[model samples]
Target: MPETTLPRPRRLLLLSVSAGAGHGRAADALHAAAVAEHGAEALHLDVMDYVPAAFRKLYTDFYLRLVEKFPSLWAQLYRITDETPPDAAMARLRRALERLNTRSLRQAIADFAPDAIVCTHFLPAEVLAREQLRVRLHCPVHVQVTDFDLHALWVVPGLAGYFAASDEVAARMRARGLDPSRIHVCGIPIMPAFAQTLDRATCAAEAGLDPQRPILLLMGGGAGVGALDDAARSLLRIEADFQLVALAGRNEDMLARLRTLAAEHPRRLFPQGFTRTIERLMRCADLAIGKPGGLTTSECLAMGLPLLVFAPIPGQEERNCDYLLENGAGLKAVDAVALEYRVRALLADAPRLQRLRDSAVRLGRPHAARDVLRQVFANG
Candidate 1:
């Protein structure tokens, strides 16, 4: 019998935009997963980095202001866009934007010559679709829908595959005229660190926390934009003897506010800023309190950590919150009073917390990165 030669590893180009932490982080996770799972050569590129600085700033600032200062307007825009299919005007505008902002991206893709291109953000998908039309790039192009909800903006004509975070999202994509065979419900790809088993007590001790005490990790994603101060204060009102690890990411003002609150209240509150050891902290935490962004929720689900979400931004985050609540993986609170009550009630009820944890474990897809890679290289 002839010896069978192993196929060469595929080169993956994982693209995302830095509009928010979730999309960029998802790209990075997929990149890392590819390398770890198949020893593949992968380039994780931020499409915004290739665009002009002014354009990048315009995009990021518009998103921050729209979601933070004018959520209602953002929600309205989201609804309008979701309801309306892409028209000639929309295609023209998209093409103009592609020409203006994606020259560098196109150059990078040409130089890399990847075997597979996976986009975690919609902008890259648009650029890739336009590029495909301009020139016949033969590599398979895949889009990872980061949120549980589906939007029309993510639908591109030339995409080879769609990796959805949930079955609901897959169904939504199908309803929007996508071929059912092209969409894979692979869940959201998270970092490989979250998939590794860690001793909870050891992780807690390393973080200078008591191993016997229950731990609650609070965060507002990488921007630290959620109501952490209010959540902390609300949590203080409860009489539980648990430790709070609040990751006030990149927001010095918010970190200062948390520090001051920690001082005044004098509980076991660990306030930190923009950490990379979130997986370790998640391992130590019994539950998480934060805004339910897609990536954050996926990370929590992977860790089997229950969530107490508050005030999810109106579009995708709100839909993620609804899914969590519907699936029993989390509970939501809209205000300070509600936060206090939910925290106290969940903590006091051990059975309920355990049930939520069970649900989270069931919903988690720790091997999503590998699963996505298998699909990308299934034919090869």
Candidate 2:
């Protein structure tokens, strides 16, 4: 057989770790976007699979422990990184990464020589930026800041562009000396599934929720850490006839606990474990109660679901909560009792919920994945 010399197929590698479900979710969205543009044959890799098992375990476990057990320490660490100037720490971290476990990463990048690199998480982005420093890898490094705020970790020394989650984030990047041209102001990337699903009535019925009662969907991302029990308690105090669907997200214990408490009032509350059908759930929901994780917020916005913020982490989540509150996409709670008051007021006032729905729909960029693909492929 004649050797076909049409050049090896161009590939796009999606580098992400399961540090949290949010990062992997973003990677999945970007990978789908890339594949939509270049075809599935050109797609390769799930970075979580490429790293050493022990290191992967450590990476995921450390973050889980920090968020679960010692959130104050996590907050302090986040604030320290958050306050670092763009010029100082990113470069320092870039240089410090010369000794990273780049054997697999480098070979993958070298073999694929990907037309571009899209990063949904910070660590892989840092590793790639430093790999460029170490070996001068030629592809453009496109960093997708998966949250609504800018973290210093996302500010790689030589990134070609940042597809930010919001305009507020773009402004912060500019303040730190990033050129406007390098910022795309693209809303956070979401799974094409979100873009495709459009069955509000059907989803509501299937979830065993009332079509007439105002529906509250509660979540706290993958770890399921929030004042959920308190939030549910507040909802009950509000005297809302609303049906609630609480996503307890990998917190099996939390889900089980909620299940037992909620069984007495099955018509009023539903507690679910880690789920992939969030897009469907969001469409059926009337309001949301949770911390504002970026991807979760994005999915909620895409469905025009208003949020009621109860317990946002001190750093990124605080920033997300600010964005929603500033834009009227949601409201914040001062504490458990106060949170209940807010829920009662909002749920009782149909006009207020409608206005929030309008705000959320306005804030949503359903075609963000298209914009990301356009930017990435336009370079190649």
Candidate 3:
């Protein structure tokens, strides 16, 4: 008779950056999934936190300002970065920037010595690739492409695998010279809470929402960018009786203003300021109206909630919106007037709403977290 022992559980290091919150949140979701489903010891760190404070501040501030005020410039930079060849001057500049700015990042990776590394942002992947080239770092690395569109920056030659949000992205990676076999077609990983089924009536009541009325959930991403007030006001113009759940994340002034607006208006408006119950709120919502960031759109799809995409930032958000519209999973409205029309029309057409909902369900990868964990270990 013989007995066998299982191999030691893998320690997964999930790296992210807080540039816009989606990267860090995606890392968190993957970490939670690894621990709960695979019993893996996982650590999630914001790569920006390890970098020098001044560098972190400059990087984040520049990114926010560029995307907010100079969207066309952001789009141009995105294209330049994406199209840069490996040996081009742009590539040399990126490598130099990583070396000059990310000493702490290299140290963090060396200290952790994880069995596997998952990068939710491209910066970490590039830094790790450089470190691996310079040292004996041999841990398997996998990249979870945060957006549906595959940017060239996310592709570094030595990675073990690439997890993409859709097959189209996988194909794009292949076109960009990535090996097809190394690419996986898993959607972006989201928190497991979005996968669970909860009673809509109970969730609605807990959030102080009326179960009988149609619920429209509006958001402006984590930074609370975009015209939240105008969007809400325009949606309110709909003659149909409906409830609004406005999530003004960390924008206290917006929250206060929304509260005042709710007080002055007759329609029921639930103003929230950065709450953790987004999964619950999505469950209680008939439609999700917001900018189509990678994470927000993924969360909505995970909850089987149809999307009414508002004005998206010109680069990645625009790419994400294109994916949703192309897949028949969402509708886009570029202005307040268009937003109002989309909301009213979708509300009035039950069949169209159902079709969008079905498309969302079909496209959603509720088990994406587990799928990613499985793919990582299998490839390793």
- What would the TM-scores of all predictions be? 0.95, 0.90, 0.96
In the range 1-380, model 1's lDDT, one tens digit per residue, is 99999987779999998877889888888888888878889999988879988888888878888999999999998898777757767756855876688788888888998999999988888777767786757788999999889888898766889999998999999888888889899999898988999999889988888878888998878878876887787787789899999999999999999999889856578888998989999999999998898999999999999988888899999999998999999999888889889888888999999999999999998878888888987844
Q: Rank the candidates by TM-score, best first.
A: 3, 1, 2
Number of clashing pairs, model 1?
Answer: 0
How many collisions per candidate? Answer: 0, 0, 0
Over the full model, what C-alpha lDDT does candidate 3 score relative to the true structure? 0.87
As a TM-score, model 1 comes out at: 0.95
RMSD of each: 2.5, 2.8, 2.2
RMSD of 3: 2.2
Worst 10 residues of 2 by lDDT: 94-103
lDDT values, one for every candidate: 0.87, 0.78, 0.87
Clashing pairs in 1: none
Model 3, which residues run further than 4 Å from truth?
1-8
What's the CA error at residue 346 for candidate 2, in Å? 0.8
